[model samples]
Target: MIIRREHAGDRPEILAVVKAAFPEPVEAKLLRELFASREYIPELSLVAESDRGEILGHVITTRGWIGAEKSLGLGPIAVQPEYQNQGVGSALMNATIEQANKMGESTLVLLGSTDYYPRFGFVPADSMGITSPDPSWGSHFMALPLAAHKPGLHGQFKYSEPFNAL
Candidate 1:
């Protein structure tokens, strides 16, 4: 399988993959809103495709902020059900992280499973003095410092408006 940046033509298939990956339509709906928002960072949206050109997974990172410091927000990572344990999601995630590093993003935050994201260097946001807008997220809110760690970076983390609506 090949991991690459998502292209315009991949939208419909991406949507299908996302929708099929989750039990609810919420994630798919959030993806659509995110793509249309100014916070969307095209370079950080990626797909895992098979040799036959079928997209197997998708991941995206968008503009976010930790107080005044800019950050990246990762979310809605989805893999087609058949491809879940086949490493498609991992490939897409690795590609997104690599691209974010190359683009000079200092950090990335996400609301996800602690068990799943720790391998990617994510830790509880509270560890860095960062709090999520939604209080209920608690420990599920994670952050990873991509560049050199900044001890001074601490504050409320804000995702794009579309996320608030979700």
Candidate 2:
């Protein structure tokens, strides 16, 4: 399998993979909204494709803010149920992180599994002075500072508008 940027044609398959990966429909709905959102960063939306051309997983990062400063919010990453534990999700994540760094992004934040994300260098956002929009998120709210990260980036993290709508 290989990781690559998502294309417009991949939407349907991507949504299928996301829906199959999670029990709730909220994530799939969010993904649809993100695609049309102004905050959408095409380069940061990626897919993991099987050798046979099946989309095995998907991930997206959108424009977010830390106080008034620009940042990124990652979410709704999903690997097909059959693809779980096979590194498809990890590949998509590494590709997104690498691409974001190339774009000079400061940090990538997400609310995710404490066990799964730390391997990619993510830590509690509060540890870096970045507060979550929902304080109850606590440690599940994490951040991974990129190569362009700066010490001054701190304050309430506001996700893209669609996220606010949710």
The candidate scoring highest on lDDT is 2
Off by over 4 Å in 2: none
Question: What TM-score does prediction 2 earn?
Answer: 0.98
Worst 10 residues of 1 by lDDT: 144-153
| lDDT against the true structure, each candidate | 0.89, 0.94
lDDT of 1 at 122: 86
Give per-residue lDDT, candidate 2, residue 127. 97
With a 3 Å backbone cut-off (N, CA, C), the pairs that clash in candidate 2 are none
Question: lDDT by residue for model 1 over 1-166, one digit each (tens)?
Answer: 9988899999999999999999999999999999999999989888888999999999988899988888889988999998788777777778887888899888889999878888888899999898988889988999988865587889999997789897
Count of clashing residue pairs in every prediction: 0, 0
Q: Please give the lDDT score for candidate 2.
A: 0.94
lDDT of 2 by residue, 105-128 (tens): 999999999999999999999999
